[model samples]
Target: MAAKLEGGAYLSSFVDAVLEKLSPILEDDDFVLEENDSALELLGRLERSLYDVGSVLDDAELKQFSDKKVKKWLVDLQDALYKADDLLDELSTKAATATQRDPDQLQHKSLRELYVEACDSLKLLPLGDFPNLKKLMISKCQSMECVVVPQALPSLQYLSISECPSLVSLPALTLTVPQLEELHICDCPEINCFAEEFLPPSLKTLEVTKCQKLASWITSKGLQSEGLTHLWLGPCFDVKSFPREGCLPASLQALKLSNFPNLETLDCKGLHHLTSLKSLAITDCEKLENITEEHLLPSIEHIYIGEDCPLRWKLARRDGRPMV
Candidate 1:
């Protein structure tokens, strides 16, 4: 845009000048920012450019250029605005005595910035101090072994580890963030346990499918969550029993049970505490021999049974109320 400072150039012509300026900055042999850091470094470079222009340009002209600049406000702008300012200060003092190949002279540099780069073979991961994460999907990471929670994952809310066959364990939970409400640990054949002591109490939903050992989570004493409203426990063929009543503090509104081959019975002896039961569905549980009506949920309003099951439901109501 500097080429049009004479006022003859139309605002439509801004791209040519912007590109002209950007192309050289990219090619500068002294520009030594890593590919990832380039976004920030570029911002730093722009701030530097604006500062350089201030030597000959009036504050009004600089202000005009600044006010008219178009920004996408994506990674690029964040890099320039945030990283650029930090770079300005770092470089000002280090420029004279800086011995390390100044990234300013190179197109790229290596970064040990925030989180370690995902490796091809590493399966288990520890993300204790990860930066600005909103999602961490380790589904395809079949070789993972364990993950450690980061300290300040303020943005993280969604985490999934489906189909990780080799994962054995995850870090003990130290962060009880209510913001992280959705957790998916399905199809992880080897993941036997989670941080029961530190599991998020505010979790409202969990999907633990096909993970046979994950049944331990329901029984683990350390899990004190009371807020779950929806639960999907499917393909957990090894889970022979539901966590006995009173273990789950929340009054589950919707509970779905499916595909537990070894499950003999669903004894909700503790489920009486679940006063808010609204919908209960059971399907594909071939081994379920009985569902005692004595403790049949009082508030339960909806029921959907799965296919391939024959049930001889016994209504033992003393009042002789018509069976639902």
Candidate 2:
């Protein structure tokens, strides 16, 4: 059909906050500031990009390069721009206003998203529990040690809790608002395990980083299913040994794990029945010495690992023969 112009881009509250945080940073850096003084300018560029992306949303090019990188850059930038609380407050105000003023507005609608430059504590219950919230993100709470997510938010599609030094663990699934589609938990030293109770089946995409004590889900030696699409446990601590039965889920597609200092081996003895695992990644596993791939899944297509890991990775075909 007709290619639309770039005027319809609706910058969400989070995006506005991103632009705000970037405003002074660009200002502080004389060259950057001189080049891009107005956050509106960035907003415009982003809008145009989104408009272009709208036409090709179904294409892999848009999904892989544009959406992934652009969206992820926005998130990572929100995570990195520290010491910009005043800027964040201004944008948060705008977000709050947008929430109250227009319910039918569809320019940019996100469920739960937060931007904290360097906070000691967080009180997000005031943000309220809106069922439409798809993503909840709070970053750079430097002094913040504890967080309690409101249980009323069940339609939560994606939740991101990052860079909180004091966070230990997300209470429990049963106590949570509801299951989500994707979850990104990174850089929290105290938090461990995705959920203290159960793995919500609604979860598909997960990216975890820098959480030291990440071993709480031991409900079964058979933590396998077809629902898991993207799985990541990286930049975490004290992770050693694959699940005793390993993930026997026949629905796994992509997996990434790196910087796990204590990983010793990957013996998916429990996953012998799996026949649908595709991509496998293991990186920076300092202590990983061996990979007993005697009966690994037969559907692996992509494998990623770290150079420091001395394990010899190979697949185990049916009838138990190494395909090295």
Q: Which residue runs does candidate 1 get wrong by more than 4 Å?
A: 1-120, 124-132, 174-178, 217-223, 237-243, 312-324
lDDT, candidate 1, equals: 0.55
As a TM-score, model 2 comes out at 0.56
Question: Evaluated with lDDT, which candidate comes out highest?
Answer: 1
Q: Write the per-residue lDDT of candidate 1 for residues 1-324, one digit (tens) a residue.
A: 244443423322332344344554455445433344766465556646644533433343445545654222122333443343343333322222123554435211322222222233554454443334556676555466766554545555777776667778875543634466777888787766665555666577777888867755554442456677777776765566665767665646887777766666667775676778777777887776565445567787776655544431433234343333
TM-score of predicted model 1?
0.57
Query: What are the candidates' C-alpha RMSDs?
Result: 14.5, 15.7
Off by over 4 Å in 2: 1-117, 121-126, 171-179, 194-196, 215-226, 236-240, 246-250, 293-295, 313-324
lDDT of 2 by residue, 241-324 (tens): 764554535566776767767778776763444456677777788687755665456677666556566663322223433222
Q: What TM-score would each prediction reach against the true structure?
A: 0.57, 0.56
